[model samples]
Target: HFGIVRFPQKKNIVFQELNYQYSFSDWIQWSMKIDSDQKTKEEYDKKIILFPEKKQIRQVDEPWFDMLLHKATIIGGEGRLGRNNVIFTLSLAYYSSGYALETCEYNMIEFNERLHEPLSSAELSKIVRSAYSGNYEAASREFIVELCQEWVAPELKNKDLFIQRKGWWKFKKPREQRKYSHKKEWKEDLVAYLSEKSYISKPYLTLSKKDLASELGMPKRTLDKVLKELKEEHKVFYKVTRGRNGGMVIASVKALFGTIIQVRKEMQQAYVAAITEKFGLTGSFVLNTFKQLAAPYKQPEEVRLFTVDTG
Candidate 1:
């Protein structure tokens, strides 16, 4: 005969044979056997015990599971699932949801302590829905860092009601230092700083690397190393004049565009001269032909090519 065991508090149901000797602990083991891989099962077994003295559920190695159980206790009540049954219910929920371990760990940290005592069913459902739907693997590092900050160091003091016992706050202090080591982000910040300075001052003005390092709050050695790499990549240049203040200058986008326009103008003039010589046409005739060809794209103002008079 088949009998159904319903855990109303956990919203879980299990089917068992009435004729066989089946304890709730046996059901948990059986469920874990089917659902978890050997590695995960072994790890879970090492951390958690089915039944303990005074029925206190002890989670040893798995912080994620410990947090989950704590949140579950807050939501479902102390006696809803026994020490033996809670893991089984949560395990079933976890396996059925098909989230990776990394995803679960990160998302759990993000939504940590969001659910609390005197919980409403609607609020619980929303929290559960977010946990299930979250894609931590797809999330960017910046986004994860920001979320961690919000969890650990919220702006308003009143919002710090549910600070997690685990060291989430430990993350906030070292994040800026960690970002300095990241080459891509560091380069982008440097470029933005240079661009802002170039805009405020005249374009293509020489900037002191020492002053720039001081302004950016970075070491001169680090700035020099990054500048050397950027110079090799043609992203920046330095003017090696014999003076105390002479140093590197960031290339301006406006100056580059002006150079491009000047080159194009010179190329157009050469092409016109070549056509005049080939056709044995007069300079005026070739010039008129070029103007007719460009008539469709006539500019409102005359185009003046940029030039520096050395004389």
Candidate 2:
């Protein structure tokens, strides 16, 4: 036999159950030893009348209870998801907070320690909430917006921000995740410097690696790397000369011609043809006309004649 009971508490009521089981032999013995007398039968009947029938209660599984347990595990911060794991990271934060679609604010101090740049508290919270609610498209959009602001903003460029640290942007990947190539920028600056000096007919500049690195505000190793790339591309020529003034001489091959010489041979031919056609003259006539036109423009050299007479 089983019975269900509800215990009342100050705040809520708790439901409990009690159960008793009897074997076949015990039931048979009890049945056979039943009272036959009228008084005993009346008492048995009264007892039976006093007790209520037991109702069979089926145990139902509550999925929500299991979900709550899972959520608690995540909220306890048992593990960390990598920055590259965007969806998983957001989901973890979401489930941990009791499946909250949004959080009030992001932990700025934590972010600053990790990413070196603290994102806006409100923006990060909204993005996390959006990702948690399975709005991946919206979450992605918000994430990209923040990433651009942090990574590509003009004011942020050249700043010694910590882009190498992992898990910098929470759900977004770090800048170091992809290899950065500054060869183009370096080459441009180097070329510009060469061009400036070459303008004064100085096609080459000699400087030590350290000095060049200092001028470019980069490490010597980085300068070497950029120079190597520039050399391979044939965009700039450099060589180390040996002497008291031994140093790396960077030459601008393209800048040697300070002005671009545009040959107009075809234009000259066209002009000759037009003059011949318009004047209805032969090639010889055009040639003679050009000679006569140029004669007036020619400056004659002064002639000094000395006469030595024999007496």
Candidate 3:
């Protein structure tokens, strides 16, 4: 709706109009920057949820909320979806005495925690009610509509009613359950399919279960069963999301120097932790390995078996 409002008359630009540079170096550099920005945003977003507040109180979720909102504000410095929606939701939830939003600070925290992620009206309702410790399930959606109407802006207040009126419940189901979970025999087929494609991110290493199942051509339930078998057999490591629901990644163990170590899996963790732990060894080890490998692979001189040089 926002995009439509802003660019109603403007046509979508095509690749030809994008004025893309043709140099490999420029393209690679640009791609890397985009990938880096995307990764940083994802990491920061996760951190916001995990530590919503900064100061920890025994039996109080205040500190976690503070941390989340703070991080959300920092990331949403550009005033994009992350910041505005987070602030709006927290403000609304807090005003409604949502248990999840213990106070204004807590509400702000949750808003930041859920930034940029789409939630169905039902899911939003569940989250709002869950904010409070006390159970308060109403007879109908009237309470939720009123809460939103009172809390959010005039534009956003009626979003719940809009969602319900438009039959948004149909889209609320977990993606994996709705799509995959229907068959059991497609495990190997799914793996083979995923293995064939070179993913922008690592395949089967750290993606969501839904994403992996989609790649595998199996139901999410079926994928779960297969993943369990694989993890038990030490065939692959599916990395689950932390805090909020995260995806799974396939961590294939590699035999290096008689040691069964997950090269990619371990390194990814080390890389993530290194950002927090400057003394961490993961980043250093990978860097050293790259340097060592590059030196040997470099060609000092070129030899021609058949030379046709005219002097």
Candidate 4:
């Protein structure tokens, strides 16, 4: 139903004529600042969701949301799908709660001849509801409607008229009958994936670029970008294998003189502690020595990780 957008200013201009329940600015601002309303803030806290980008909690008189709202483009006069229907610039678009302002087929042309004759999103929703159960496709859907009735959550809007089984339950039944006791979950966590290598385990070490992307369910283009970042961070390396067109990804392991050491964030503290105890090093002396050993690999601000050199 929605896609992330780049270049908010450009997107605002592109969707200037569409109807939306919440503006893009509001969505982005909420992530940056909490609500000013006391009751609203209390309810938001109850949800247990944390916004990492949040810089400050809003004071009652703050204008944080308005600051973002004013940056967006808006259409004026008439010719809109319905009344009070604003558009999103860099966020998902949705209609207002129980908004019944229907643009007539005849009136749509009058509004925008550029659009040509077509059914509006509202009309399309009605058509889609016909295929699904009435319990699910209820009109004027308002789950989480109280949380800015205009900004009701998508998942909360779901409804079932009768009892039903979750899709996974059926899958589990067959596995249980077979006495299956093991399952491996596929999570798309990049950090967790990179940090969990065993002594002899280098899963992606031999995977070709294409196969790696398929396993990660990532696009080849995106995979290339991620690999580049990982390589720069000394986390992984992309080395071309002999007799192959596509290269493979290898964990950044430093081998010197008959000894090997893997440089990873997970190993950093342990490496530091060991050196501190063995050589009686402490404080800046430890950091300075680590830096000397890990030179040519500059500490990229607080992001850089270090390991004891095998020398």
Error (Å) of candidate 2 at residue 65 is 66
- Using all chains and alpha carbons, the TM-scores for the candidates as numbered come to 0.28, 0.26, 0.22, 0.23
Candidate 3 stretches greater than 4 Å from native: 1-185, 197-204, 254-311
Worst 10 residues of 4 by lDDT: 86-95
Deviation from truth (RMSD, Å), model 3? 28.9
- Cα deviation in Å at residue 148, candidate 3? 68
* Residue 247 in model 1: lDDT: 58
lDDT of 3 by residue, 77-157 (tens): 221223333333344335443333445544444554555544344434434434332432221233333333333333433
Model 4 per-residue lDDT tens digits across residues 164-213: 33333324555336543221212223434544442322322455767766
Worst 10 residues of 1 by lDDT: 78-87
Candidate 1: give the clashing pairs: none
Cα-based lDDT at residue 140, candidate 1: 25
Over the full model, what C-alpha lDDT does candidate 1 score relative to the true structure?
Answer: 0.43
lDDT of 2 by residue, 1-311 (tens): 22364566755735434465677788767665663466687888788633344443211122222222122112111111212223223334434444434331233224322543333454345434544444232222223233223333424321222223222233534535745535566678877777777633344677887888887666678788888886666455577766787787675534532211111434444544543454344656544443332221121122211110000
**What is each predicted model's overall lDDT from 0 to 1?**
0.43, 0.43, 0.40, 0.36
- Better structure of 3 and 4 per TM-score: 4
Off by over 4 Å in 2: 1-181, 259-311
